[model samples]
Target: MKQHITRFRLRSVSAVAALLFAAHTAWAVDPFTVRDIRVEGLQRVEPGTIFASLPFRIGDTYNDEKGSGAIRSLFALGLFKDVRLEVSGDVLTVIVEERPTVADVDFAGTKEFDKDTLKKAMRDVGLTEGRPFDKALADRAEQELKRQYINRSLYGAEVVTTVTPIERNRVNLTFTVSEGEPAKIKDIRIVGNSAFSESTLKGLFDLDTGGWLSWYTKSDRYSRAKLNADLETLRSYYLARGYLEFRVDSTQVAISPNKQDITITVNVTEGQRYVVSGVKLEGNYLGRDDEFKSLVKIRPGEPYNADQVAETTKAFTDYFSNFGFAFARVEAVPEVDRANNRVAFVLQADPARRAYVRRIMVSGNNRTRDEVIRREFRQFESSWYDGDKIKLSRDRVDRLGYFSEVNIDTQDVPGSPDQVDLVINVTEKPTGSLQVGAGFSSAEKIALTFGIKQENVFGSGNYLGLDINTSKYNRAIVLSTTNPYFTQDGISRTIDVYHRSTRPYQDQGGDYRLLTSGASMRFGVPFSETDTVFFGAGGERTEIKPGTNIPGAYLKYAEQVGYVTYSLPLTIGWSRDSRDSALVPNRGRYQRFNSELGVAGDARYVRGNYQFQQYVPLNKKFTLSFNTELGAGKGLGGRPFPIFKNFYSGGLGSVRGFDQGTLGPRDVTGSSIGGTKKFTLNTELTAPFPGAGNDRTLRLFAFVDVGNVFGENQPIRAGEMRVSTGVGLSWISPVGPLRLAFAQPVRKFAGDRIQKLQFQIGTSF
Candidate 1:
């Protein structure tokens, strides 16, 4: 016969007295052997759990001491609400009240966090579906929800949890959260500063009182983490300016009684400025002291700058690592003379030992193949560790554009002092995109573009793309593919097939179209890590459609060429790019030389273009960029250069502040017949958008542009070039890269067409 009895804690006065009486009376009766152990009141826990928790077995002796220990052990499991042991005729009966099971967790009024996110967070802290539920755990969950909102600057947020008992030993939990408005920073004040003005010091901080752009930057909101970072910036500003003894004494953050406003006050000590006296080397340098000394970035007579000191130390450490000293240590010991206001530094170095790489491991590349990444590594396994090559390998993998993050870590092999393992980790990003977009312009009204590209198809380092543009005036279709490892020797092969139709005067007059179709195959041979040479051949047929608005130059050409032309184009090009970032590059040099020769078919001509671009970072927030392009073409074998192959320069991609493709010689009826020679120069000063909190996605650029196209018979003249100065904005938004510019032409001829505003979206600059 089975009997069920739920356990109840000995909390009542009578129950406690009875437990004491039983304990006192237990000495009167001799300890008896346990015949059998029976467990009751268990719903979810197995009987074996109780058997394993009990101190006495069925064949062992049972006493009050054993019963107490058994109860304590069962209660410690946290799976039971109450546990008790009772003895009746030597058969010990164990009773347990199982904790209520969580049937379903629900949330109400929670807008900031996803429902599943909250459920998962609770699961991590021992509260989940079908898990034991307790009042203490529920209280902790409520506090955790509030803490999340608090971190987001919602000081007045509240979370209330309700537990409702249900049938089948289950309880439903509901967490209702009221996320209030974020607290705003009302005021920021700096005190105890004599070297710099309050405004100047406050300008160095990211957190501040609300500004016109605060809604976007969120700097007006109070965030402890952001505040901490700003404090560090303030300290660095002083340290870099020769205040070697600067100290941030205290910071006070106050919140209003309503919890809607915050105020911050910073106290700092700006000690006397100092100058560097000298620098010396101290510790063992492996006999390369002179080589290491040349790497110092500090000047002896310069003001004592902490940044320079830190840079000098880091350079020393990196130089040591380049010689297989992976565990090198370098420290800058400063000797300060307060009376003379000068500081001297003694660089101490310790090259612990030399090591070689034992194994090369790659991880975190879920989509990209291993070979695609390994081929970029110049450092080989089982070779002496070369820090410079390892860094280069890491950068090469990062430049592939398939990974968002790439990291190299050296791990010491166990029991091997002179051996280490190199681990390369990469986090993959989405490599395929299907983009469809439409933009509006006063001239075209609406232009639609579509593109589908896969940079790493099926985890192979290959590229396939299709492009289609459907603008009433310009329409085209292109299919292209590239195999980055064409011959498994780092050479790349690309094939392209394209059909295009262009109307030169559709915006002004009738639709006179030029239709062209062609295909090309190119191979890129990498001469160096940063340089490539491309050579290819292509065939094309061009047809000129009859129309009233056709330019005089085109009409004359069509009559001689019979309204059709054919050409076999040979192309050779070389390019070198060392840009730190393809988007928003701060420092780099990019140059390209391209030549096209029409060798076979109805046209014989040669055209070449050379372009160079350089970017220099003037400071942390500003970059100076310069670009120049030159193009020239001439007929060969007594045949004129193809009219459709002429070069054009103006507008957004060239000299702005003028009508697109209108800077060259004009044909009869005032149509821009593109010329055979093109030249352009562009310069820009770019910086992050103001009040954007270091977000590189948005930037502002001021530029100067100069260029013009020259006809086939016209001599290149610098006096005829157009010049413009303008300001532009570049934003890398979720949709695409968007550019907008406002320009004014400084010099223009009487007949020059002027366009002051230009914009384009859905393209990378």
Candidate 2:
């Protein structure tokens, strides 16, 4: 049978509708064996693409069902704008109109986002250059552009897409965007919060109506994600304070007609506050009930705290998993007494069948090597699942600083309840940094410094660093490298080479100079997860040239040890850090001890130093910190402590009000000659910067500093110690930690050089 106008056009189309139309007998053709197959309207799409989509091949039988299937399959590819099939005397011809290829994508009038950002958003919706163009795709692109603006509180933004057809069946697309004023949060109201004042409850939220720092924090911007998070915070605040049944009933966000202002209202119910009556444990505890009981954190007669309940349950589950019960269940079921306003908790635990790790897999390491990450894992394949070891392994990987995220997933083996697989997933990040800085001062004229470091060299977990400093008074070039995992057991090896030349601190040229050149090798042995001991040996050569204004102590030492001296120094150091955070530490302690011995050298001596730091969080917005450093040196084998190795004090890191390296014994010419013994104490009270709210990156601190350096033969005394108190600003800037201090010395000797104001980069105290 033959039919006229056999083609069926499709638009805003559905494959099912096309299929049903072709299946009708009135529009279908009789079944026949195909003699040949051909594809039409192919500009860039290959002929094989059409052949692959057809249900039946050349010389194959053709029927109504086969033709319908063929048409649906071709349309689903999205490569064609229209498709039709014709059958004449057993020869099947597939005809299609290809969608126009986008020649270019351009954006205009977009000020908030970069042009490339908008293009990427368009590409995400399949409307970029070289892709097929259609009206639906254009509409999607416009919607995506508007969504991007909406996320930034630009609800009034508009988008217009223009398509221009060019030669060769291609089109040039342009998206014009208009971003209006951002919607500012004008008011926030808490409808029903009584236990705590509305101001107190609203203070817990990061979002606010407006503030002086709003331009920087953008806390006045309205976002659904932020609102949801703030609501969760509000809920948690009440739950922790014994409000057991607190809930948010509704949240309303209202916008002005002009779309420039928004108002938010949250309705909440603050339930009755209850105190904990008792805590009881139920279910199996693996016969270690005594050990498990010690993990309970709930305190009877105290207010009910959801944090404590959660901690107790998680502790039980982790303990069970530590004993190979990987699938453990733990819950805190509460019994509430409404009349007495008291609650009791029953912790239920279940230890399922023990599971063993059948295999361990690692993935998502595109740039890093497998061995680099595998060596950090403590959990092994074919071993009983130990949750403690797995958590330690994850922490060790995170400490490597190579990955931004690390997760360990446990999967049960099919048909085997006792076997599981562990998959370690890692997300890699850049581990290299380059720092450049320049400073001007009266002593150093124009100083410049550059440093480059790579913590994960070639993804082998090695460290390579270079430092260069150019200044009038001091110049140095240093090169260093370290292999953190030099041995299978995690012993580290470091090698360093450096050359330094120092002159007296002055703006003009100096006749005297001190040149030092050396190389060293160090080995670090980890004593524990938080402690490491390092030992090294170095060979150094020091040359001293005599001229005017040189320190008298230096001349005396050089006369005894000669103008040139060579020394072989042996170094030993130990450090332990349990700080919770490296920046803006709230609570923690750090200690370091180092000793240097000139075992075999022309100028033999011994020196040792110790440092301690402690941070105590006073509250959410304030911290009390203390730092103390002590140093003492002595002569060994009848030789004095090397004058060049003397310690200096009274600077930004020490007594801030005094001049840099100026608080010690002075020569006849009044130049500071550093001392062989040093003692300094620093105390600071840190709080959030004014107007910044809870932003931790910027803070203000008030500090008190006491102590000074002592000469080799002088006895240390409290009367001689200089004292200063001041306020300062601490910012975690892009370059480094910066501290600016304004100090006034309350106790100082007449000869002391008072700086009054000083600042430095890259030091905390």
Worst 10 residues of 1 by lDDT: 6-15
Model 2: worst 10 consecutive residues (lDDT sum): 4-13
Superposed model 1: Cα runs more than 4 Å off: 1-106, 111-132, 163-173, 441-444, 562-566, 688-690, 762-765
Predicted structure 2: lDDT: 0.86
What TM-score goes with each of the models? 0.89, 0.94
Pairs clashing within candidate 2: none
lDDT by residue for model 1 (344-445), tens: 999989999999999999999887899999998999998999888898899889888999899999999999999999999999999999989886753455
Q: What's model 1's overall lDDT?
A: 0.85
User: What are the runs in model 2 whose C-alpha is more than 4 Å off?
Assistant: 1-28, 115-120, 437-446, 503-511
Q: Say which candidate scores most in TM-score.
A: 2
